[model samples]
Target: MKDLTSAVEHRQEHRFARSRDPRSAAKILVYHPEPEDYVVGIRRALPDAEVVFGSDPDFLRQHIGDTEIILAPRFPVEALQDAQRLKWIQSTNSGVDFLVPVRERLKNTLVTNARGVHGEVMADYVLGTVTMLHWDFPDLLRQQAAQQWKPKFVDPLSGKTIGIVGLGAIGAEIARRAKSAGMTVLGMRRGSARLGEPVDQYYTREEFDEFLSRSDFVVLVVPATTETYKLVGAKELSAMKRSGYLINISRGSVVDELALIRAIGDGQIAGAALDVFEVEPLPPTNPLWTMPNVIVTSHIAGNPTEYPRRILEIFFENARRYLAGEDLINVVNLARGY
Candidate 1:
């Protein structure tokens, strides 16, 4: 596989070479709620730039025409037509699905994301979830709710194998932690044959079935895209070991919700720990919510106490680069939809 670090650096350099002169007084918009210090930091970094903050759609729409840059988790695709001077968007979230709808309008604009910032927190969530499922923590919780005591034998993670579907920033971190816990790590990447310390074996998409068959825990970390939409469905789930667990910290669309519910109900796979879903807030009526073996968390795997601070660091660094006419980091490849 191409060294992700080098690939990103090369892309940044290429984009910087084509970049125009830095605007002396660009209008910036922060469409998400942020700490006061974050706004101060941006102002400090771009002294001459005009910065505005608002969470309302109307407010953002009114300012889109003059805004040159936007730092937000989500933006109204319909407002792109009014953003005459918009040149760049820095997404606070790692995934850029919010911008996918307006991709054509963004053809001339640069987009960057908070990719590296999420690795640690997300890894922690993956590790915790995997262990909880493996040790039957949900059953224990149920017993507690009944005011009864029960003990059950549990499998150890040390001797088991973990398959990480996406070997990106978050996936790599999960591999590292899983390896440290004594699990053999099997990783799948789109390209590159290089094997690393944490990963015992690397499988390309062609070997996905083999990867699934060997994993005791399958972790999904890939971004949501046309190619990834419902990437894991009935066939893939059926290929997994009956005792294996699935963990998804990626977008909900990556897994077919109906197939997953059926798989769990039919005992095709052991269980799943889901942090994201095809729908947010995961409606109370959803079967996954009521499934005994399933563990669900509201799309908060990457949210940590220091998330704002960490993301702000990325934004500030990129803002400085923007003002200094240097290459910005974590630049997104709009065509790849990451």
Candidate 2:
């Protein structure tokens, strides 16, 4: 009889061995708006490696040729044409849509993301927004502005159903918090019927409509991918409960912005809390900015005071694995677009 677990371990070992040769000496490029102590941490972790620090396109272009590794939130995809020796890229951001522009060029490059780091803060944002909508925070704000003394009935979060569209790290954290608040947590993910802690029920993509119908709040946390592009369209929006609120902490492309505007205008759903947009800066002329039922944030959900430190922890650990010829954490499957 074959030992399945040992066989799986051996297969993984062989796969990583074929991926990259163990090399302590490599050129690393650090390009981020707020790297903080990342360069220092990377230096300590990979003492033999040469580190180049720059945020300007010209400086990055000048050093791209010799860069074996890159640590950044975003990089110019077009400039990657000059990076002849690039082997791996570690994105400080969890979503890697920034790499989509040059997906073909990254076929051979190993890519990892800062995934688990943002969950806590992002979950807090979702909870806060959900509570605001449920408790009618907007009405109170308007009353304060007009010096009115009206008291509106608020809905309790207890026993309310929250359907999280993606059961990744961020979604799991949200489920944890929602469950702690006595809310019924439902989760939708790619596959598997198994229910984990925090989530009481699990649904696959096939059962998305049923999930939407059951939820009092629908949260989208899926990554931006071809399969997920506009995953929440008019049809999906119309399936939700009339009083259901939508919260998007994921990529803007994951939901149809135009469809969302229509849904809100037509009262297909109660309202939405959006942290990301299809066109960011979201344009001053965009209707969402002035919508009474909607709450728009400039995509700062994952940005806490400790965000840089958290991201650096992932990067530093991955650097150790890269030099030790071990499989890296959060290695993105380019084909899967996660």
Candidate 3:
């Protein structure tokens, strides 16, 4: 990986060195290729902006010098410094971990995320999964597979308590949907400050255990950050009700894999619905796959059929805000890592 990165960087350096005109709006730098509708939406949003698409390190280094802003699916961390004119970065991913490399270097550049764009889609996923579990859909499937027609009692989502670990756009969306389902929504944020939303109450990190103890379902939507690393572990998992379920849509590392495995094995929580994992592709040897109570997905929570177009909408909205000298929406707080 190191050798491949070095090679890419070397190519980028050559692109930067060979380019004669470092300033051209027609070549506004974009990192990915063939995002037809996304590109169109961006163009429509910034009519005068020029768009350039390249993933090659060399091409990026050379062409980024004159780029005013980057509408990237993935930020070119190593090549960001090459773009002397870069004023802002619109990331396709909600998490801003990719920006860690340039956050300090590009102090003057604004960083925004596709926070709200993917919220509804992800919320739908969570809502659907929660409903299936509540209605004993899994057991029904099992009975059908076994050639038996056993009936089971089920409960409604109404009056159940849902704990939202993060209150960002996605979390807020989940909270709204869960509440509308008649579940009492309890939010656990880093602070106690109230956000304009439908949360019944909010708790701080200090109250995480207390919050977990009372929830029927605990959903994690926090970002990946040093502070959030292993936020949910043995002790936290132990606090949950034995009849409750845990749902994770956030980065995988937020929950400790070993602890989670133990929790489920010991029936600490009823089940789990995991989108992300500590390791990608969830290595063949991982036990979580075979765990009867755990439902695993290959990190598809935020991926929607219209993902690219929705992201472009946010880009256009932010572009309008940026040019108008207004506060951009979904701006990331580097200190908090959201």
Residues 237-278 of candidate 3: C-alpha lDDT, one tens digit per residue: 999999888999998989998999999999888989899999
Give candidates' CA RMSD values in order: 5.2, 5.4, 7.5
Candidate 3 local accuracy as lDDT? 0.77
Query: Candidate 2: which pairs clash?
Result: none
Best candidate, TM-score: 1
Q: CA lDDT of 186 in candidate 3?
A: 94
Which regions in candidate 1 have their CA more than 4 angstroms from the true location? 1-24, 33-37, 193-197
List where candidate 3 sits over 4 angstroms from the true fold: 1-26, 43-48, 193-196
Worst 10 residues of 1 by lDDT: 1-10
Ordered from best to worst lDDT, the candidate numbers read: 1, 2, 3
**Model 2 lDDT tens row, 1-338:** 11111111121222322223333356789998766577887777666778888888898999998777799988877789997767778898888887876778876678889888888999999999999999778777988999999856766799699999888888889999999999999999887644565888898888889999999999999999888999999999999999999999998998899999999999999999999999998999999998998999999998878666788788777665654556779888777778
TM-scores for every predicted model: 0.90, 0.89, 0.85
Per-model clash counts, in order, read 2, 0, 5
Model 3 TM-score is 0.85
State in Å the error of residue 8, model 3: 34
* lDDT by residue (tens digit), candidate 1, 1-338: 11111112223423322222333456788888653665776777666677898888898899999777888888778889988767678898999987876788887678999989889999999999988998878988888899997767766789899999998888999999999999999999777745564899998887889999999999999988888999899999999999999999999999999999999999999999999999898998999988999999999999878777788888877766664556788888877888
